[model samples]
Target: MKIKLNQLDILLEVAAQGSIGKAAKALHLTQPAISKTIQEMEAEIGMPILQRSSRGVTLNEYGQVLLRHARDIDRSLHQARDEIDNLLGKAMRQLRVGFTSAASYGPFTNTLIQFQARYPGVKLIVMEGRPQQIHDALENQRLDIAVITTANHTSQNSMYYESLYALSNTVIAGNQHPVTHTTSLKNLMDYPWLDWDEPGEHSILGQVFRRYNLPLPQNIIHCSSPWIMARMMEQTHAVSMWTSVRLRFPGYSPNLRPLVLREVLPASSIGILCPNIARLSTAGNTFMEMLRINTRDWLQDSDALEMVVRV
Candidate 1:
């Protein structure tokens, strides 16, 4: 029998669980294989590593010493990989950026475009999802950065948000809808209304519903798609509630006007969010800068209210 570092790792897991059966299950190995490996390890080390009982196994002094060193080695190995990856530019070779569907309509899109233009050598992968979904992906190491709103999760990792632009919540209705001509909410109450009835756990737009409880007309369009919802806004006299960003999309709000609803609809801020990983690749940091600059222009540009910024 020969002592080996790999066998030592298996020994550590077995010691922590106090049973070969449990360690086998955790490591996807057979209990006999673990037992044989540990037996061989004991033979090489010339020391008893465990004491068995009907209930389970317990590590003796030799096992404790081995386990401590195993853990330290495991941690050092991972830290070394992360450090070497940074030194060799693993971060810049590829990237996956995530954004909410709403952001795809503007800022996020622009940032990716600029990032592509500037770092053509780097591969870019983009994913469109809800804020919470994106946040979860980032936390799990599935995404590099996710542009999300406050209702979404925040991370303890190095995270930063540049609130580059804000969208004004406004009243919306189809072009021919009778209420489109009405100047105030009082006059608009006469028609069937379409509302952005949020489903599931998404409550980002609940504020708009609170101020205006007009019975949502029977013919309402509750959706998760900004593109489909915008088109629906133009068809039926269904009065839709949306942030000012929707108006600027090609098919939305071009001819629509903000409803003078009874109460003011609060605006939502959109930003570029970055996780402070020990290192952000040169391309990633540069993309972030481009996003900020692009959004600043869109936020200040009213002539073309809805602006799409592609990253």
Candidate 2:
């Protein structure tokens, strides 16, 4: 059963506007022409697509099925035009990437710089959010790539993820804090602590205390952004649980120091997540390659880990 693209477009417009006359006006077609086209569609499909009333029309179950395919066709046609324009060098390639707050401390910024240098014509958009927000954006196709913690969410069939590296939660304190000189966990808890107010029982802070069979710190300061926490630690005696990679970054040093705890906190996997590789755009794939290569180089660098310890 062959159907015209315009017919599908008309059907979608009608569904959107909830009125045949309104859809006709929107599409610059006459009301009778819109009505006849929909009739022809229903006849060809051998089912009534919409339930009509005096006020307007709404999609029936059959209409909903057709609307789904129509939307897919619209998306594909737009992508086809974009891909063709990119190939002809007439349009800039664009990639939308999403990440959690932890990404600010990771190698993402450095890799993005290399990607920009290599693909100067490509446009990059980066978004920072909580893990749940990033997951929602990925599922909605608003993001082409995501870097998130493994503890965030489990990958489903549509979401593909690969572990880039493991990250250990480190306790950070001001350089002048008394706990900075101590390796004892008991002494570390004597000061006020700051961390995200994450409700999960498996959060790094909760897990660290559970592993030691100790109660959680009562003087915990709940804050979300790691940058704020780092800045606060620089000025105050407040300690926070953060990724050790923060030390490797440029700004966290000279003031912030990771406490040398006797027990190691469990390491969490930091993964590169995207829609199945096949769904990635050219720019997305290129960025992914650069990210993987940079991350590998950073991990293999002996000096990087040493810098973490010195911090």
How do the residues 39-129 of candidate 1 rate in per-residue lDDT, one tens digit apiece? 8878888998888999999888988887788788777866885677578665576777887655666656877877788778888888877
lDDT of 1 at 131: 64
- lDDT tens per residue, model 2, 1-311: 78898798789889999999998766656799999989999999999998988988999998999999999998897699567757854344777889876664547788888888887777778898866678789888788788886543345543667767766677888887866454866676778888665645536677678779988877887777777887888888898877756676667777888878788666656778886554466677777888888877877777446433221
Best by TM-score: 2
C-alpha lDDT of residue 121 in model 1: 80
Alpha-carbon runs more than 4 Å astray in model 1 = 1-89, 105-107, 149-159, 181-201, 211-220, 253-257, 275-281, 297-311
TM-score, candidate number 2? 0.62
| Model 2 pairs whose backbones collide | none
**What value of lDDT does candidate 1 attain over all alpha carbons?**
0.64
